[model samples]
Target: MTVTGHVKTAPETTAQVLSAEQRHADELAFLAAYDDGARPPGWALTPRAVVTFIRGSDGEPLTLPAERRTGTLPATMTVAAKFVGERSLVERCVVTLAGERGLLLVGEPGTAKSMLSELLAAAVCGTSALTVQGTAGTTEDAFRYGWNYALLLAQGPTPQALVDSPVLTAMRSGRVVRIEEVTRCLPEVQDALVSLLSDRRMNVPELAGTEEGLIRAVPGFTVIATANLRDRGVSEMSSALKRRFNFETIHPIADADTETDLVRRQATAAVERAGAAYTVDDAVLDALVTVFRDLRSGRSDEGWDVERPGTVMSTAEAVQVAVSLGLSAAYLADGDALDLMPGHLLGVVHKDDQNDRARLLGYWDGPVRRRAEDGSAMWRRLWDLRESLR
Candidate 1:
């Protein structure tokens, strides 16, 4: 079958990445039956269930009431946490959506802002495909509507010729639409959403006097947008647009141990997906996380001052570094994963500024050397490998 002008293909079994909805289809279905409480219109799961879906069930199995049990779903299930943040934050996001208000998640790069948006959309609407990836060239058509030139010319400005943008489609269907990196879009293009959100209706002047001309949003329709804090000055959001949405700041994982575990879990999954055993040692992983946290926060675990890199040393980047280390350990038989750290770290630090290399070297001279002096064998090895930074 075709959607728009393109043929829709069957699900690729070997897809490298799956959307939140596809990855957690079973949990969604189970949660739908698991929660019989009131749900906002067009929502697949109740508000509470939506929260539970994103922030797992804390290892406790939830039993489906016998009356609601079905053959496809198990009797009892333990929901797995997909987004690693506070349950209260997820609850606030759900509440915002439930009220049908526009939600804007603002955060530093790689803070799982997009991941949280996808998870919430999937839990609420049963699909996370209605999305617009904002960029410098994005235009009003992306947030409002577009046209099929062929259909427009052949049939005139009719309903069939009008192509629905993701936001428009979401409005009509009463589902959630996600705008990723909203700040990347030009200021004028970003304004398209202000009126749309405020009015909850879009006037298609091209189709004026027709039944489909004025498109009104149905119940449960909402918008979820994400903006990276690093992109604040790129295209600052207008006050009007900001007022239409409830803003939530997604912070990086606060606890070092939690961040380390997340990095390990995500990196291991990444390596295994590449068909390799993730054999990176725990000690190496701990040291790697320590380096990332120290650089990102500009302070060492021991409270020693360290220079921050120009490039954001995000957890997501740390996971990639861990994945690289794991792959090197798995494939490169002669090399230790610990020995490969300096080069990968150098690559991350050197992204935006070459001067960051000096900062990285300084970190080694301070934290790594001090830890080595404190008799940590792992830190000692890392210290010995400082020449790798050059």
Candidate 2:
């Protein structure tokens, strides 16, 4: 039988981003041997180990306890934190997955819902590739199964003619399947999951007489789906569909320092991928993240009422802006990355509403000017560059 799933490609040095499994192969292997706790049926790592894989060992070296040691694994290893969020939230997600329930992560765009999903899947099942990208054009066949048309035409609906969807493959193999932007799919197409999730099995009507027609999920089969708050009304999910999944709201990083650090690290990684040195000053990054937070929260850190932009000023967007500044500093010219902030901020603010331009200017007039008045040199430079917003 043919499977319709992520096509395996030979590793490319220039691959912009590697799968969670590919990028953290060593860590996953280490965690497996490090933890001897009982794993759910068909899981690759214990629930605790899975959480550790995502949250890191908090910079401490994890020494495999005396009894669980195998000569194959290193005696001690350090796992870097991958996701930046509450450990309790990660624990809750792990618990849901261990119970084999559908997990629905709802959040604003770029809150790392998808990243969390990938990490959980990779840690649990050793792969984050069984995926269905939900879009308005997505059809039911994308969730169920398709046919190898050439084979189907030559030999009727035999088992060999079946092309398993990612969801079907996950069911047969007892792995986690991810559906991104689940709400973007048409309601009818989204309903296709209700029976599969509720029954934990799928029936192939074309091959009804054959034993292969009925495919039941083995243990460890579950799903992790994501939805953007911005797309909530585009295709509302039926109450039946919502009932099948445990909903978790993923929020933006609450602490300014944590968010700034994450932006610096991510932007540096991105610039390095392009073979450029990241030279954007930490001051510039802090300012950039400050603007995003102000616009995102609709209030300045100092309790000033700033006009919020209609567009989402997310942390992910802050990283992009920082990367742009870094790239400009590295490749284009010898100037402070701060010089380009206004233009980038303008670009981001103009995404959804034209009036947001005025909102951004209001932000500059309010917080930026006040910070400049308070003798902050970085804010002073940003204030001088205010004409760029026009």
> Candidate 1, residues 1-390: lDDT per residue as tens digits?
222212123333668799998998999999999999999999999999999999999999999999998789999999988888888889999999999999999989999999999999999999999999999989899998889999998999999999999999999999999999999999999999988898999999999999999999999899999999874456899999999999999988889899899999999888767666778898888888889999999998679999998888899999999999987776665488888889999988897777888999999999999999999988898899998888
State the local distance difference test value for candidate 1: 0.90
Error of 1 at 170 (Å): 0.4
Top candidate (TM-score): 1
Model 2 lDDT tens row, 284-348: 88889988998899898899998878788888889989989987887676478898989988988
Residues forming the 10-long window of minimal summed lDDT in candidate 1: 1-10
Residue 95's C-alpha lDDT in candidate 2? 99
Show model 1 residue runs off by greater than 4 Å.
Answer: 1-12
Q: Give the TM-score of candidate 1.
A: 0.95
Q: Which residue pairs overlap in candidate 2's backbone?
A: none
RMSD of each: 5.8, 6.1
| TM-score for all models, in order of appearance | 0.95, 0.95
